[model samples]
Target: METQIAGSIARMDGSTSQDAIFKDVLAYKEVLAHIMKTCVPEYKDCTIPQIIGYIEPNPQVGQVGLHPDETNPPKIQGMSTESTTTTEERVVYDVRFSAVAPGEDGKIGLIINIEAQSKYHPGYPLVKRAIYYCGRMLSAQYGSVFTQSHYGEIQKVYSIWICTRPPKERENTITSYTLQERHLVGHVTEPVRNYDLMNVTMICLGKPEGKHYGGLLRMLEVLFTGRYAAKEVIQILEDEYEFAHAHTMERTVSEMCNLSQGIFEEGMEKGMEKGIAQGIERGMEKGIAQGIEKGIAQGIERGMEKGIAQGIERGTNRERLQNIRSLMETTGWPAEQVMTAMKIPAADQPKYLKLLSLPQ
Candidate 1:
């Protein structure tokens, strides 16, 4: 039960709602253009208006398909702000779209994917996942962007990751991994356009006062960190960056602030609950030991062990039930959802459900 509550608290701390809100803000054309102008080399010198024009009408957010079917790929259309491969191994991209890049001869198309990552180290190396996403984006372009034997027409792909919480050493850093040609033996040159098809950019954000806190990093920090109130953020966006969309930005910032506050309050409540539970458990253990000694003195030693075990079990069950009820009440979630969020086992759910249904 303690472990369950801790897990619930952790999930709430890094909740999907926060991620969704981040995605919502990032999906805006104005925000995306700012990011590309600051972080992407292709749009580094372009004006925000030009960059926004290059971006397609709508970027897909939380859509299916890292690998849509070659015969019938998902159509890139509409203005909704929100992909997967196979049915079993499908991957939904946080935000994916196509954009036009200025080239020497003509405009070139580029596929761009933007991800809002909450954790810097989520078990696996995030760079590998970014690379994999780039690969999938390139491969999924086969039937859509270019047909067989027309590999030259394949558009370049970029997977940009915005990590909200990175390790201290990697904080406020922007690293790019792209296909670069190295002369192994002789001075042979190849066109960059032919081979520079995949790129992964990792943008790790840290404290706003960090060394690298300027331009894109600072803008993202202000947006995601929830350090400033919505009005403060809006003022920064307007005065510092001259962002035009005040109302939209304000709404998004407000949503993020609200969610962050909720998570913080929930975490504090859970921490207090955990501290109280630990203290109660310690006291119960001490009392049980004293009772065992008294039982031995009273010549009831034969039943002491069984009685102690039952008492401990009952105490644990009561605590677990109380935790469940408290969570359900606080979250306004149903019993099933609360139990699922806490990661309670399916086998124990029926028993808990029965207990929960009984009168107090």
Candidate 2:
């Protein structure tokens, strides 16, 4: 029990599933029975047997509340009244153990509560256990508060706990605490019934000084050794692993292949979208260039018609305008150059040409 409980798969809030808990419980039933039997010696009476019942619906293992004191208190020198109110509050468990025993009142007593622990709340487990035992004994006697008198019956309780770790740095593996009364001034001070406490036996499982914890030590060894020694207990504990290393590798490869395929498909989809966008932009640019060229051609044609009309008006109205076709023949210019130099009105070009020694 000196080693700490180690595991790669640690328990978290959401890690536990119903199936996991059920499977684990079934597999570790033997260990659970052993722990319970060792804790509660009364079960060895050959009457009551250890059982794994369903999880409690309403568990009050860590509950604490303020309650009124049922007894009187001590008086101070200047105090007027000799009474003071106090609180007595604790948690109660819901499970029970059935057994018959002789009570202090020389009557047959039936102990009800078996065992309970507050695993989460720091140091409240032992306190909660005591309160639960008390409550169970009280309930068995009166049946219910409405049916019988308060504190009538005499029942017994046995509370036990199994822990993986120790409480703080305490040395003793098992420690018990109980209520006690001390004499004060002159007359015995009114009994501080609220402080009428009980004992607690804390068994720190982490101590391995002796062989008294054979079962706990074995459990711890299995957890810490690292080497997988296939004992019956280890096999039961390993019921959680569903596959061997080879099968695990195969499953991992399969999942990776699926993920790779999905990534490839997604990348292709994004590429297609980008390509479509670029294609549309290129088509629009090409269409705009073609339109601009066509507009420029039409504008050039309109300008040519306007220039011809103006040239005809100038030749007919202005006397200074000369038919330069005779100057073009005298100069012997090339066809293109002649056309440029002989600036004649197109409407009067035929009459002007008849006047010159030009061919028909």
Candidate 3:
């Protein structure tokens, strides 16, 4: 039953099962608290419990924003994980919620959106997407957060992207882009709170062995990487990170690992089957072209062997080249950096570099 369920989950659309599991784990108050303290400037100095208290429970996961109508004005249209535009365009969020700022005033709150990004170079600039998300979040607040030009009531917005597989140079790093006040002439400054409403934070994660793999980086790596067993992950979270939700963590982590294994196994099986099919086809083709019984047999035997080997090799190399190109184009990484990060063989580096030099 477990295997069957895993298989079913593995077939979900575009890693949906894995993404859902990640959302389940991250939605935990304890986990959110850790992220808040480590990533959010407002909660940087707050205690874990304090941060947890500030976080509203049952954050909307995969929420969608509906277009406001006559009955439901924009002011009443609450925040959600996704929003539908007039043109039927959709913007979906992984996790979206509001958290009160840790202060005696208790008036300021943050509208936060958390995204679990599996790809680092997803065709376009991720930072720009993050900024766009921030913009959407801010604009979404027009009537819900504050109405009728009451801009002061506008809560700060944060779009935090946790990139699981980034380039080596960006591994285990957290960078934030926010509204910074730059003065060109006289040094007069407005209050930071007034203009610091939008923030985009990118947290790129690598393996746990890196020097910077400590604190939030290590914690997230352990939770999402599936490198360790569920029990071990839970133990680490509890002992090292002081996470108290042992049972929930264990269950979610275990589910994620099982689903990931299922997906991996399914992929491998498909790859092998495809390679074998190509080998058989090529073997038959060569045998027919020979037009001799003995020659046909020999041709098929050789073709089968060569085709199997070359099919898999070609597929792998093609994928590697695509990844390298994507990294270079999106991250602007030099060919050397991309090759090193991808661990391309020294002998093959020149070939790949040459291939990269050609115009796409």
Candidate 4:
């Protein structure tokens, strides 16, 4: 869309939360739906109409209804499957939203939760948080009093977190977590149907090792990072008519740049290598130069002030000592006279008399 996404917020701080930008851009179902389909590969078959249901999560808000049970086995990427499952609570999400889409069969629906995290969360690691969110979303499906009362009615939950900074060890940008049915040699367990109830996907927008990325990944790269309006991306959006490509993509990207100026600059510098705009580079350089210039000038000013004070003290002391010696040799003045003329302390008269060879 040629229409510009304009907002009252023009600049963003490094520590600024991306929740506002996220809410504004993803508010469009077309954009949000496109992201859901792109980020979660398993849901590629599900149509946008089948996927998007609620925008943001609120405990105060009631669940619309139970989703269709169409959860396909999750494909874990960049990690191995766990032989066991755990019952633990997920950390509260910064941004929580839901979606509904049918599975491969086109009859069963999946419950999706989209999460956006930008800041560095140390109290809870990203992986742990991802698992927690998945568990919470899965458990939240069957509301005791509100939505689906039946145990069978529980739908598959997709917990997707778009983390700005991922774990150091994980090199890949996308990480998925899934449950697998594994049999142990020693442990006694009964054979039961293993349902992929919850799937956790962490989309890490780190600099990819490869040069090429799919349309979905490209959109996310631009959206999450501050490299405003990559020409190639805009061309792709214009070429491919996805939910986000329908004009909202351009507006959303523009709005993000116009409103949050610096969100794109932090996290990583690889964005610069990806052909960021020259103006942004110039702005950053300008800021750095200005800071350096100001510091140098202040340092010089303080040094000059100290130097002048020291010089004056040294000159005054030298003149007083020379005058004391001259008075003793020229007029053979008394100690009191020399001390008074030089404005020297009374205790220094004896030292001055001894220096001039006068009687102490």
| Most accurate candidate by lDDT | 1
Q: Across residues 1-360, which tens digit of lDDT does each residue of candidate 3 receive?
A: 122123223225564567777776666677777887978989878898777767753334443235332222111112477876687457898888887885446647888888999888999999998888888888788778789979888889888889887899999899999889999998998988889899888989888778788999998887776677888887888899887655545555688777656655776899999999999999998877766877878899999999999999888878888999889999898989989988888899998877767887
Question: Sort by TM-score, best first: what order?
Answer: 3, 1, 4, 2
Which 10 consecutive positions of candidate 1 have the poorest summed lDDT? Answer: 1-10
Model 3 clash pairs?
63-81, 63-82, 65-82
Q: Which regions of candidate 4 deviate over 4 angstroms?
A: 1-17, 38-42, 46-98, 104-106, 119-121, 144-149, 167-172, 185-194, 208-212, 230-235, 240-245, 249-251, 265-360
Q: Candidate 2's residue-wise lDDT over 195-294, tens digit each?
A: 4322233444444454454453444323322223234334433343211211212222223233334444676799899999988899889899988998
Task: Give the count of colliding residue pairs in each prediction.
Answer: 8, 4, 3, 5
- TM-score list, all predictions: 0.63, 0.31, 0.64, 0.50
lDDT of 4: 0.56
- Sliding window of 10 residues with minimal summed lDDT for model 3: 69-78
Ranking by lDDT: 1, 3, 4, 2
State the displacement of the C-alpha of residue 55, model 4, in Å, after optimal TM-score superposition: 10
lDDT of 2 at 5: 14
Give the Å shift of residue 164 in candidate 4: 2.4
